[model samples]
Target: MNTKTLVSICSPVYNGEDHIEDCIKGVLTQTYENFEYIIVDNASTDNTPSIIEKYRKKDSRIRVYRNEKTVCMDDNFNICAGYCSDNSKWIKYALADDYLFPDCVEKMVKVGEMDEQIGIVSAYRIAGRYVTSMGLPIEQNVFNGAEILKQQILLKLHVADGSPNTVMYKKSVFFEFNGFNSKYNQSDVELVFKLLDKYKFGFVHYVLTKSGRDKKGGFYYLVKHGFHILEYLDFGYKNLSNYKSISFDKDEMDYLKMYYARAIVSFLITKCAYFEWEDIKRMLGNIPEDIKKEVKKTFVRDFPKHIIKYFVSLLRRIKSYLRDKKRFEQFT
Candidate 1:
């Protein structure tokens, strides 16, 4: 692939006053300069537009466009991506609230330059607050395609490159899929899964994006997206309809179990945090009796102590907020 310009970047911004400055600086200051920065504004009420205007004036490469109306994150990203003129080689959606290392694009461009067939290139991300499920920052190594398939079947959760921030896709291939799902909140995961389904990805083996501020995929965002968990699960199962190998090797099956585990925890934590009993009941209602039993078995085996500590933590959190000293004073 004899590409003249190396890369194109798209950023989706929505009421992101807190971290937009740093996010822009991260891209503009990249050690790799042959790139276009496209900022897609989703009608942010904040001064996000002004900040973008400021950068566009300074750097001839930076471009900004506001969506006609508020669409979903996926559509905003796809729309912003379409705004890029480079369309030359590789593309990456840089989250408005995230920063990246200077060597980021340099390393990814090197990978794509060497390998044209590589549909996707991703690097390790430092999972931060709202950045990942892990409580602390962690690095993600590439999951083998075979292993990824196995994990999808077993875990029922698709771990497509740790963070969307760390992913870079070939521009041609990106548009080939018609971009992203504008309707679903969980479209990010869907986009990655569908991309991998059709094309092979090469792992870049470097740390790129920094979780600058908690934007998307934070605990609350996870709940909002994960609300459609069963829907996503059904989607995957529908796509892989002929998948008959329900039972696999012990190691593989054990790993798959965590998918169900995280799915449960993600949904449950949200319901528990907000005390949304009805939602919890609805989540449980979606699962079959067999899976419920499996869930119970999993709870006991994997997170017995966690379950106990969670309830205790919830009670403590609740107690701290409600100032009902009179009720306690009677007991005292």
Candidate 2:
């Protein structure tokens, strides 16, 4: 990588006062100097704006923005990307709560330049303090989108554990795909699948990002994150066949089971059992009798837990909605 190449690293955070400062610190201290660091304060009600302003003045490369109206995670991120320098052909979207390894960006940019067809380079994100996927590390490999996507679906793994923070892409390639679709609250998983057609992923294979979990205020965030999972499922199923995927084309039975498993698990986590039952029914409707029994068996094994969580989330949503209604009527 040339030392003179300009780069951009950014994230959009809502009420992210806690990590905003440290996140900027990590970027400013990066071994690479020819880059701009940005933080989009997406209408944070908390002290996040103040923190960002402090850093903005301290470093010329550090810039910040606050959305006038609150934007969801996906839209906010795209807004941050829109601010990247016009010369920035390589772009990155890091998380408000995640910091990169000192050399992460430098190395990825170098690798990106090495292969022009390589649309994105993903790396392992070490969970420094978060409980994600495997309670382990996720390493996204470097390969053409089609072959890697086959492995992703067959193993049923979120490609690179399914978050954009652990990856960097050619800015043009990402924008060509229209940045990211905002129809999903957590659409990054589906984004990987869609990108497979035109982009080959390059892997750096090191733990280059650290996501710190257990932020000070976590309870509400946990619920929101759970709900985001459903948004992901909605996107995945609606566009399932649209993805330019290289299917292994195993028996139809295996495909059926996987489809069922994906839906039920997503619904169970987001606590959207009934809301998503239509999708599950459609999937089950096409499967063999034996496969149906297996689905039932798998679902039954943890029936009690899923039921409890689903009802809890449903109740919470109901309560929140009711409270909002009461407040809305008073203002009107």
Candidate 3:
């Protein structure tokens, strides 16, 4: 009798013909073989569907599903997850653009089985050339989810939450939390934060997955709209009450105030074109009124100093440009 834990691996793809084969091969070649590979194509108009079908024929473990209509990415993710076998103990998301190391599932499952309280398991991931999610201690493999969540909020740790591709979720815990929130673009981050608030976190200190770091992907979208920092701040603020042991020292509070102030100013200066007023208002809505007022006050008090610095930098750039133009004219 094969007694190993059954795992369900899912890949949600849309126009992913470029990397779907690699993603599939990563799963098919997993060192741990007792698992199902689910591929949900989000109505891809390209060769993605055919590529998936090619693999499904070769491997009976591969299951393919197609959406009649292309759904939002978050919705598609939830739809993909919904197809997991009820008998499976864990759900591992292998993003269409990202592939796993051969031992990825084996390693993540080993850590997860170490503790029943561990609701999420994460490992280091290669983001481009650098290994990321590195704040955890070298020897420690498990953590109190609340403490990890607190540290993550305070910017002290980043081991527990990251791209779905880098982590595995307890099947029960995932459904208990109702999966991803379709309303937020950063729903994966949001869901991980929510999970860490009430459950233990497990970490495998190995680089198990490679992130594609697509410049046109979700992270870039968040950064382009200036929603990345604000969304994180909003998550931190909303979860503060849940971390009863967490307390901010005066310095930390001051730093956060300045950080919030700078984010607001930076968004206005650089990201205004990509954001609507309503979108900005909604992002800021989750943050507390007191913190909002404090940051506004901080921004007001520091406005003149900021203006002076901006003018000085602007003047220097203007001088450099004129000097360069003069040098070119003389050469001509």
Candidate No. with top lDDT: 3
TM-score, each model?
Answer: 0.74, 0.72, 0.85
List model 2 lDDT by residue over 1-332, tens digit each: 65576888987899877787777777777786788887888889999888888878888988877799897778888899899999887777778887877888887887677677888777667665543333112444356777766555544544454467778878888788877777754466567666766678777756677776454534235333344334333444333466655543557436645665645554454445446555445444544454456657667676777779778988999999999999999999
Q: Rate the local accuracy (lDDT) of all candidates.
A: 0.68, 0.68, 0.84
Worst 10 residues of 1 by lDDT: 132-141
Return model 3's CA RMSD, one decimal. Answer: 3.7
How far residue 183's Cα lies from its native spot in candidate 3, in Å, is 1.5
lDDT score, residue 41, model 1?
89
After superposing candidate 3 on the true structure, give the runs of residues whose Cα lies further than 4 Å from its correct spot: 242-255, 272-288, 300-332
Question: Which candidate's TM-score is highest?
Answer: 3
**Ordered list by TM-score, greatest first:** 3, 1, 2
Model 1 global lDDT (CA atoms, 0 to 1)? 0.68
Clashing pairs in 3: none
Error of 1 at 102 (Å): 1.0
lDDT score for residue 110 of model 3: 97
lDDT of 3 by residue, 1-332 (tens): 66999999999999999999999999999999899989999999999999999999999999999999999999988898899998999999999999899999999999999999999999999987888999888898988888887778777777756699999999999999899998777888889888987889999999999997778888888886667776777667545665554667878767666666676755554333444776566545655666678757766776777668777888999999999999999999
Clashing pairs in 1: 130-218, 154-256, 155-256
Tens-digit lDDT track for model 1 on 4-72?
A: 665788888998888889888889889887788889889888888888898899998888888777777
Model 3 residue 315 lDDT?
95
lDDT of 1 at 10: 82
lDDT, model 2, position 62: 80
